[model samples]
Target: MSKEQVVVARKKKKKVKIFPIVNVILFLVISLIIMVPIWKVIVDSFDAKAGYGMNFLPQTFTLGGYSSILSRVALYRPFLISVVVTIAGTFIGLLLATLGAYVLIQWEMPGRNFFAYMLLFTMIFDGGMIPKYLVMKDLHLLNTLWSVILPLSINVYNLVLMRNFFEGVPESLFEAAEIDGCSPMGTFFKIVLPLSKAALASIGLMYAVQFWNDYTNFKIYINKNELFNFQMKLRNMVMDNDIPDEGGIDPNTIANAAVIVAILPFAIIYPFCQKYFVQGVNVGAVKE
Candidate 1:
């Protein structure tokens, strides 16, 4: 090659290398921007002397903040409520998503297209908040845990994701099941569900997170304080200065500690679910 061509080739190689380097630096900077505040919160949660200022490490490391929040009898009801709501909501959501997705995949089922369209319509629109509230009242569901659980349980996005995953199941499996004299429900239980562990874990985690983090529904629908979930109680603690007195622990410390406690479940659970979560999302998202 000519000297000029050789120089151009080297420059091109240098440019290619520079792009990846720039991308690495860009992502690192973005990661720091996101993680810095989270790290600060974590630090403050442990810091008995936690204040409003930025802190990378706790000046006075202590678990008193956590102890105070946990020991408070007032928090117990809300914590239990949150656990019940999360478990029940996740179960119902998964049941609806899986069953509805299965039915949508039955090519011979009458009104399948119409049903799918109706569900899709809901994704585009809904009755406004007041009307929904009125409906809940009419159903005599207000001020109950069901008021919180039922409203958020029917997520159309999750339904669509599950349907997509179900569609990805090989047709041959169904044919084989049919040849073996298996009923539709039997095939679903034996074949479809067995093959859908990843999707279930992925979608279940989504439901659990949504239900766990929910506060607005609880705030709006539940009038009884005893029925309020952890998120609701946490909001009260953080926003309304309602932290329970635990020997005059700094309110900031308790609030930060509560924040950590709130997120801790997912922090521990996500690592275990991550492999299945990634696979499920990928399979549900991609198509031939």
Candidate 2:
């Protein structure tokens, strides 16, 4: 090769390395941005020595903090409540969303366009918090589990995404099933749902996250302490500032531990769901 060609090739290689280095640095920075706070929370949650706030890292580690929250007085009753709500809500939400999406897209029902528009409209405009509260109150759903699950049974965005997923199933498969002994219900179970598993897995994870993090609905709709969701309880532990000093544990410990607990479960579960999550979320984003 000519000397000029060799120099140009070296320069291009160097340029490529530089771009990759920059990208790596950017990713590291963003990771730290996410990791730093989480590390602080986990550390502070156990840092009985650091007092109110964490500094860099904990000087001491103690299970005392975690133990206190689940101790006799605390026992994390709210966490149990949250767990039930989250499980029920996630399953119910996924079921309704899947069925609603399937019916919306595959069926030749009356006023199909109107129903779709109504759902689409919900995504754009809400009945506002006051009206929603009033409706729930009138329906006698306040302070009940239904208050959390019913109002958001079918997330409009999730429904649309799922509908897109259902539509992506091969029409030929449905036709073939129909030609056999399969009815529409049989076709859905035999053909549509099997192909739509990834979408459902992904949406189920999304609903799980929503259930875990939801507070506004719980706050407005459920007033009972027995019914408090994890986020709501964690909010109280952190924001209330006057936690009345449970047993021997200090205020800092309660706040730190609660916040850490609130965040930890999602961190553990999200990666498992990411495979389908990325696929499900992206499938609806582009036109075929």
Candidate 3:
């Protein structure tokens, strides 16, 4: 080959390398834009310097924000209530979603298509707040945690995603289970459920996050402060701008602390389920 051709190939390789480096730099810049704000909040929560404006880093690392929140005996009850509601709601919701998805994917099930359409219909439309409130009142679920749990137990979108995952499971396995005289329940528990960890993790994480962040239903149905969840309490604190502290701690610090506390569960949970969550999203997107 000529020296000119060899030099041209070298230039092409250098260009290719430069393109990837540029892309990497761009991605890094975008990631920092997103992450810096979050890190700022976390740092400011522990910052002891009394101020209202943003500090790029912790001005003075102290537990004043955390202490202000922890000192309030009132905060614990709401925290506990939120934990219970999130755990119970996520479990029950996952159970119902799994069963519903399994049933929808069954080819022999009569009226499955109609039922699926009905579920989709509910997704597209919902009765207004007044009507839902009236229904809850009639059911005697008002002023109770079940008021929140029952209404959001099974999200139609999550159900459809799970159904798609179930469909992706090989038909041969179901047939083999049937040949062994396994009941539907047995097949689901032993065969389907075990293999559906990716879908379950993704959907369960969705439910957990929803339950954790729920505030509207709690505010509407629950009139009693004692029945309030962490989100409801946090909302009250934010609106009232009253952190129960005699010490002159910065309110911004308290607010930032509350924000971190509110999202901590999700931050901890997502990393563990991230692999499954991504896999579930991709697999569920494929057309059956």
Q: For model 3, how does the per-residue alpha-carbon lDDT over 60-117 read when each residue is reduced to its tens digit?
A: 7778788777778888999999999999999999988989999999888899999999
- Pick the lDDT winner: 1
Question: Which scores higher on lDDT, 2 or 3?
Answer: 3
Clashing pairs in 2: none
For candidate 2, give the lDDT of residue 179: 86
Q: Please give the lDDT score at residue 51 for candidate 3.
A: 69
lDDT of 1 by residue, 1-288 (tens): 999999999998887567889999999999999999899889998887789999888998888889988898988999999999999999999999999999999999999999999999999998889999999999999989899899888998999999999999888899999999999999999999988999999999999999999988988899887888998888877898887666646778999999999999999999999999999988654343
Off by over 4 Å in 1: 1-12, 17-19, 245-248, 284-288
Residue-level lDDT for 265 in candidate 1: 90
What's the number of clashes in each of the models? Answer: 0, 0, 0
Candidate 3 regions exceeding 4 Å error are 1-30, 246-248, 284-288
Error of 1 at 150 (Å): 1.1
Q: Between the candidate structures 1 and 2, which one is better when assessed by lDDT?
A: 1
lDDT of 2 by residue, 1-288 (tens): 999999999998887557889999999999999988877777777776647554776676666777666662553787888888889998899888888888887567998889999989988888899998899889998889899987767698888888988877777787889889799888878777887767888888888888878898988888788888767876776686745564555567667786776778988888888887888776554233
| Model 1 TM-score (2 dp) | 0.93
How does each model score on lDDT?
0.90, 0.79, 0.87
Model 2 spans > 4 angstroms off: 1-22, 52-54, 73-75, 107-110, 242-250, 284-288
TM-score, ranked from best to worst: 1, 3, 2
